[model samples]
Target: MTQRTDVVVIGGGQAGLAAGYHLRRLGVEHVILDAQTTPGGAWQHTWDSLSLFSPARYSSLPGRLMPVQPGRTYPDAAHVVDYLADYEKRYGLPVQRGVRVCAVHRDGAFLRVRTDCGDWRARAVIGATGTWTRPFLPAVPGRREFTGRQLHTVQYRSPNEFAGQRVIVVGGGNSAAQIAADLAHARIDLTWVTRRTPRYLADDIDGRALFDAATARRRALDEGRADTGGVASLGDIVAVPPVRAARDAGLLNPKPMFSRLTAAGVEWADTTAAEVDAVIWCTGFRPALAPFAALHLRGSRGRVATDGTRAVDEPRLHLLGHGDWTGPASATLIGVGRPAREAARQIRDLLA
Candidate 1:
């Protein structure tokens, strides 16, 4: 069946839900297509111990705040998943689950979102598919030759599997630190790898500071003022409780990134090598814009060139929460709402 909607949201995650909230508030006819059978999108697949860097008050979508028990502070992945399911139900958002969008093709005036279930002819399309499904795996020379078990952040679940094994964790983000920390007490020997020395924020700081800094810089850009936010980026690791504890325990011994991978393991930058059983790549992800491949809208490094969240070449297309380029800190739960709201407003105008 061909379903016609004024706006078609490609994801039903935090970004998509936020866009739906705004579109409904503005009275735009829209339908949300979700690939996952349940709510929470990528959150459903995250590690059980994964926790947000902020409290419930700071981590919320547009229109509604995440509810938490008074004593329980920061919500974990399950809490987020539950809240997302509740959010969708509370707003009565039109979300169709298990409808994986295969392609997006432009036909004359409208954009046709082709999914496994049906097709949607939308005046505007919102690409809120965040970068979770596509985990970035580095291409080391002997990467394929390594016989050890390999996994990315997307596939990682628990530390039990690598309890007594020598594991090499790659990347400099919170995921790398958290995973290493989780494995530290499991009697596992761990080696951390980073391209550069990771800069960390103070112990007192968390996502609140990150959100504020990003919001300020984004506001400056929106107001036509020079971005004077300096080299302060939200990507810098924050000294979260667990991460700080790991550092204090002398478990965060990170070496400069390795040069190449051998049959046993990676050769360190200093030419010293170690025999490891597994390597966990925490290197971030590129946007999942495979459905939009027919549009030829992607530029260098698979990035969509956007004027804010709207695709430059295709004005009716809005990509929300892809990254900072799409909108400042647009990947964060708190920061995503700004871009989602703005994109929905812009999409509303386009449909009108």
Candidate 2:
């Protein structure tokens, strides 16, 4: 079945929900197509011990503030899921769940969004599909030959299964730090590895500070002032409670990345080898853009070039929640609001 709408938001996550809220406020008729049957978005798949870098008051969507969790300083993944699910319901957003957008092609003046359930033709399309589904695993020699288990962040649930095992957690980002901390009490021989020395953010800094710094940097650039490097200049890892405890206990020390995977484990350039039973790659993810592949929008850097959230090659196409490329800190719950509002406003103009 082919349905028609003024706009079709191609995700129902935080980014999509934010865009839907703004579109609804602007009196734009739009439908949100979500691949998942639930409303939590990517937060639903996060590990059991994951916690937000910021407190509830600092992490929220455009119109709603996340409620504080009793006895907890920072909210966990479950709390975030609850908040997102409630946010969708609170706004009464028009979201059609269990619809997977397979491809999006131009159909004259409208964009044809082909999905598993049906097709939708809309004047504008907002690709808010986040990156959780597309976990990035680097190609290391002997990876396929490794006898032990290997998994990425998307597949990681809890450290219980890895208790008493020799595991290596790879990456230099927040996920690596948090997962390493999660495994600290699991009675496992854990090895934390990074491409470079891990840098810890100031204990007082959190997502709110990062977002404010990014905003200031953006404003400075807009005013042709000297560039004040924002979060990038600060550090990579956030000292969440778990990470802090693990660091204080000396369980979060990281070794340099291994040169290559070995049949039994991994080996470094110095000829040092370790027999790891499992490897949890906390490496990051790329944007999930399979539906937009038919549009041929990727530029030289393998990213869909955009001005703010609007795709530069396709005026009616907008990308959201991918990363700083889409908008500064847009992938964060609080940071996505501005870009979502801007995308909705542009779509409104385009439809008008």
Candidate 3:
């Protein structure tokens, strides 16, 4: 007999765990299926030296606080995993690890989720898989001809791996900056490539009253009325102090954007080419919703179409950990809790 649940949540990352916890609190019957052998999805795969830009106070999940040493800046990736493990144990959230959902289809009034382990039937599904599953690499010319060691930021672990090698980092995101800086300390000759100069911000911008003001500016921009001419980027709005400190330590300089990836490394738009021994693509990620292509997505830029908290096309499906849910707070760990709770309530009501 196929296992049945009122709700089936894909991916046991922060968002999925939070959704499961909220559902359990509401006395709803549900199951969480994750692809990994353990919890804390992307956190488990992060580089060894990675620490959240958000401080411990801001990284807590619902009903739990991320442990931290007093006066410490932020917890490392391992600490995050430990906290997630503890969260699961404390709440007794029903999660099935090592279960990768291959496909999801509508079966009568229910959804059928087929996993490597078994088939699951649910009245609703939450695509809490998060966005990090798919890494976005630009289709530059001659990329396949490059004979050098090429790796995406997802596979990157530490600078020690690239010691004594000339490395080229691509993209203008936080990961690109942090990886380039980390590699610089190892005395590796590194060059950063970006199409546009990435706007860098200090990591302490979360505390300022101006931070709230900037959020208002972001909302206006989202509505397409006003341009965020002088407003800071998301990186600038969230945490700027640590980023500034990294820059002061000579780790945050911008390079012209990527033009091509050649056998001799990367070529920039300015026609400057370097013979890099390795290339690290710190390019961003895309949502992993291809498994549910039947559901017509409604958002701009291929993101799931949702109005505030409700999904437009599929009422039974919801998204978490999306950028800027309720203002800027939606991007952080704390932000997902409210939305998770609201989604859980809606799921419960639908089942009733």
Candidate 4:
């Protein structure tokens, strides 16, 4: 028998969980379909030494607070997974694990979601799968000829795995910095490479003070008299300086963009050669929407196109944990609640 639901949320990570929680509160009948056997999504696959950059206070699902130990700066990936599991139990969110969605198509007024388990008929769908689904690996020449074990950061776990290997950590994001630092502490031979220098932020900041200054700068930019540069917001400005400091410490270095990969290892644009035993591509991810090709996605640069609060063109489909009012935080546990809540309200109104 084909099951029916008011909504079918794809992905069982923080964003999907948040959406499910909100829908449950509104008495909406929905089911969450996730590919992973667990609920934490990417966190379940993160490097073992990873920790949240945002504080616990900001890292909670809607209507639930992340349990915290006193004086703990931030929680580790394990703690985060535990929190998500608990949230699922508390809310009794109906999630089907190990159910990989294969395709989504419209059937008259209903949306048909086909998975490995079976087919579901839903009135609407929430694409909460997030932007971290597909890891973006640049196509460098001779990449296939590399004899080294090349893997994405998603597969990285602990430094113990790369104990004595010569590792080349690619990309300039937070993941690259953290992984390089962790490997270096383990006495592993590590080299960090990126196309451009990254911006890192302080662990703590005066929120109000920074907000005031940022507001002033935004106003100046809007007035057309001053240039705000390419910075999107305060977060971008705050993160730049500290990352440069890490670079100066020899922890991070900008390589002339990736050029080619040889059987011996990798060759950068400057003709420099690094014989790596393992290559860790810290490249970022994109949204996973392969199943919903029938919905006609409006994506640019591999991201779903939305008009601030709603998905473009597709009325029955909405995107959560995407860039709406927030930046990267929108995709994190700390920042997903607001967007999830907003999406729930819209869904409720649509069903009503």
Candidate 5:
């Protein structure tokens, strides 16, 4: 049997849930399809020690605030997972779990979302599948030739496995810093490498500050004002407690990116080489738009050209929570609400 919904939201993460909340508020009938068997979305798979850069109050969805964790300033991943599960239940959002959407294709006037369980025909589709599942590993020479164990940010968990082993952590972003901090005491030898010198935000700055700056920049751009650098002008890495402690202790030493990976380890342009046990690539992720491949909507940048959240070529499609391309700070828990609301409003109008 073919299921029919007014809107079909792909991925029941923070983004999908936000979209569902708004759609329901606007009286738009919709169903969210999630690949995970349970709630929490990407938060379920994050490292055990991962903590939000801000307090629970700053990291929340629309219509509800995340509860504060007892004795914790920044909520951990498990707390976030609990909040998401509770959020879904509280709102009675229509989310079908364990339904892996294969592709979305046009069926006359409606879009058919083909999944493993069944088919759903929707007037509009919201692509809220965040980049967690699609971890990116940069192509470095001799990567395949390296005999050392290799992994990406997604595969990383606690740092116990690397104990008494030499490890090289790659990337200049927050993940690299956090993971390096996690492994600081766990590993006997650790090397953190980045494309450039890692930039750290002021100790007092966190996600709330970043989100507000992004919003201001977004407003300026929308109002035809000069481009303020916004968050980009600030810094790359947030000086979270753990990161700050690690940096102060002189444990998080970042070196320039290696020239190539040898059979045993990484080699720099200076011909200096380091033998290591493993390499963790924190290079980040690309948008997970594989299901929309048939639409041919992505451009050379591997992004769907959009005016706000709506796709230019395919007006029926809205890309939500991917990144800034979808909306300013759209990928964060606090940031996704704005785009989700805008997407829902556009969807409501489209249906009308």
Candidate 6:
């Protein structure tokens, strides 16, 4: 079947929903296509213990803010999922679930969104498919020869399953540290690995601070001014209560990355080998841009080249929630709305 719309927003996650809300306010005819059965996008697949790095006030969409209980703090993954589902209902955003967009090819003046369910031809397309599905794990030598279990953040569910096992958690980001902490408490022998020493943010600093810092840097660049400083990014783990607790318990220490994967385990820089039952890689992810592969977008390094969310190659195309290249902290909840609103305005103009 084939349908037509003024705008097609792909991926009904926070970014797509935010863009949908803005488009609705502008009285634009749009439809959001979600690959998943439910709303919430990648948050539904995140590890159970995951929580927002900032409080609820800082994690909201354009017009509607995320509600928080008086005494409640940062919301968890489940809370975020519930909120995304609720947001769609509140705004009456037209979301068609279980529709996986296979590709967005040019159909003359309009774009043809080829999906599993049907084809959607739209004047504008917003690609908000986040990176959770495209997990990245480095190709260490002898990796294929290893007999032990190898896991990425995508496959990692909980620490309880790894109880009493020798495990190595690799990556320098929050997921790696958090998983290590959880595994450590399960009485598992855990080793934390990073390419370099992990930098801990100030105890009071959180996601908001990181977003502000990114904005500052961008502003400096835009104004053609030299910055007197550089701030850490989202990778800087929030010193949340749980993280602090883990620190106090001496479980967050990180070691340099190992050289290669051995049959039993990994070989270190000093030519030392240690056996481990499981290796969990929290390395990172590339943009979920398979649908746009035909577009031949630039910026090969896990991000799309965009001038404030507008694709450099395709004027009617907008990429969001991939990372900061689209907008300052665009991949984040609070930060995504800013770009989403802007992108929606541009899409409306294009359709007009």
> Best candidate per TM-score, number?
5
In the order shown, what is each candidate's alpha-carbon RMSD?
1.6, 1.0, 3.2, 4.0, 0.8, 1.7
The CA lDDT at 335 in model 2 is 95
Kindly list the per-residue Cα lDDT of model 4 for residues 83-119, writing each as its tens digit: 9999999999999999999988888888899888999
Ten residues in sequence with the least summed lDDT for candidate 2: 179-188
Better of 1 and 2 by lDDT: 2
By lDDT, rank the candidates, best first: 5, 2, 1, 6, 3, 4
Say which candidate scores most in lDDT.
5
- Which residue ranges in model 3 land beyond 4 Å of their true spot? 207-246, 296-301, 325-331
lDDT tens readout by residue for model 3, 203-286: 445433333544566677778877553334444322334445567787656677667778777776678777879989888887
TM-score, every prediction = 0.95, 0.98, 0.88, 0.85, 0.99, 0.96
Query: Model 6 segments beyond 4 Å from truth?
Result: 69-72, 227-230, 233-235, 299-303
| Superposition TM-score, candidate 4 onto the true structure | 0.85
User: Which residue pairs of candidate 5 clash?
Assistant: none
**Between candidates 1 and 4, the lDDT winner:** 1
Pairing residues by index, what is the TM-score of model 6? 0.96
User: Which parts of model 5 are misplaced by more than 4 Å?
Assistant: none
lDDT accuracy of residue 272 in candidate 5: 99
Ranking by TM-score: 5, 2, 6, 1, 3, 4
lDDT tens digits by residue: candidate 5, 1-352: 7999899999999999999999999999999999999999999999988999999999999999999999999999999999999999999999999999999999999999999999999999999999998999888999999998999999999888888789999999999999999999564488999999999999999999999989989999999999888899999999989899999998889899999999999899999999988999999999999999989999998888999999999999999999988999999999999999999999999999
Better of 4 and 6 by lDDT: 6
Q: Write the per-residue lDDT of candidate 2 for residues 1-352, one digit (tens) a residue.
A: 8999999999899999999999999999999999999989999988999999999999999999999999899999999999999999999999999999999999999999999888999999999999998999899888998999999998888888987799999999999999888888675799999999999999999999999988888778778999898787889999988899889988887999999998899999999999999999999999999999999999888899899899999999999999887888899999999999999999888887
* Model 1 clashing residue pairs (backbone): none
lDDT of 1 by residue, 37-141 (tens): 899989999876778888888998887888874655667889999999999999999999989999999988999999999888999999989889888887888
